[model samples]
Target: MGRILAIDYGTKRTGIAVTDELQIIASGLATVPTAELMDFLKDYTQKEKVERIVVGEPKRHSNEASESEKYIQVFLKALEKQLPDIPVERVDERFTSKMAFQTMIDSGLKKKQRRNKALIDEISATIILQSYLSRG
Candidate 1:
């Protein structure tokens, strides 16, 4: 089976993650500039076999769609237009950044390292992928 890819979309940067070809383990792939995300995904998908994509849907504390949803919706439409063959799914992304921070602490990353927002984005993407995997 092809890999399952995950995206943690952000305004400035986007986090990417992918499951193994066997679809067992999810791992962080990369953090790319939001403007270049489409090109990056097009290139990566050409190099790798991706069966599906999971995008994190931001939600507020009251479960309403967050302000960021507008951006994500635009990205989603572009993504679908670009990669029409691959199916896309959305997962609620609440507290993922906080969880990613905690994971960095648990992983023993130093203070300076933990301060890298790119790394946090990557970790959050991994968490999103793991969440998708666990649901199945």
Candidate 2:
């Protein structure tokens, strides 16, 4: 089976995570600049047999789409155009960031490391992917 990729799309940075061929576990892959996300995915798809793409959908407490939804929509459009054959899905990411922060605190990470947004992004992506996996 091919791997499944998950993206935590943001305006500044995009976090990436991937599942194993068996789709059992999700691991943080990378955090890249949003501007380079498409190219990065293109390269990743060439190197890895990615069968599906899942993007984190931002929403407010009221279940309304957040402002970031606009950007994510654009990103989805681009992704669909680029990878026409692959399916791109969106999973709710309401508290992934907060959960990731709590995880860092629970893990006893240093303040400096916890402050690293890139690290948080990666962890959030991992959480998002894991949530998706759990649903299935």
Candidate 3:
């Protein structure tokens, strides 16, 4: 079986995660600049067999789409246009960033290390992928 990839899209940078070939474990992959995201994905997918993609759907606690959803929507459209074969799925991304921060603390990362926004983004993507995996 192929791997399942996940994305945590942001205006500046994007987080990426991927599961193993058996789709059992999720791990942080990379944090790429938003402008380079499509190129990175294209190259990665070409090198590896991706069965599906899970994108974090930003939403507010009130059940409304967050302001950032507009950006993500645009990315989604481009993703669909660029990669027409793999299916895409969405998972609620509420609290993911917060959860990632807490996870960093719980894991005993130093203050300086935890301040890495790119690392947090990568962890957030892993969390999104793990949530999807657990749902099934």
Candidate 4:
């Protein structure tokens, strides 16, 4: 079986995560510049068999799409065009950022490491993937 991948999209950068071939565990893969996302995915998919993609759907507590969804929608259109067969799923990403921060603190990361936005993005992607996995 192929892996399940997750993307946490941002305006400037995107965080990526992937499950193992067994689809048993989720792990942060990378933080790539938003402009390079398609290239990176194209290259990676050439090497790894991705069965599906899960994108973090940013939403406010009031159930409105966040401002970032504009960029995500554009990306999703490109993704659908590029990876036609692969299904794309969305998961609510309401508290992922806060949860990632708390996870960093709970894991005892140093202040400097905790301040890294890229790390936070990566963790947030992992969180998004984990939430999806938990549904099963």
Candidate models: Cα lDDT each? 0.96, 0.94, 0.97, 0.94
Q: Looking at model 4, report the run of 10 residues with the lowest lDDT sum.
A: 37-46
Residues 1-136, model 1: lDDT tens digits: 9999999999999999999999999999999999999999999999999999999999999999999999999999999999999999999889899999999999899999999999999999999999999999
On lDDT, the leading prediction is: 3
lDDT digits (tens) for residues 14-118 of candidate 2: 999999999998999999999999999999999989989999999999999999999898888889999998898889999999999999999999999999999
| Clashes per candidate (backbone, < 3 Å) | 0, 0, 0, 0
lDDT of 3 at 75: 92
TM-score of every prediction relative to native: 0.99, 0.98, 0.99, 0.98
Candidate scoring better on TM-score of 3 and 4: 3
Check candidate 3 and list the clashing pairs. Answer: none
| Regions more than 4 Å wrong, model 2 | none
RMSD to true structure for each model, in Å:
0.5, 0.6, 0.5, 0.7
Among all windows of 10 consecutive residues in model 3, the one with the lowest summed lDDT is: 68-77
Model 1 alpha-carbon miss at residue 67, Å: 0.6
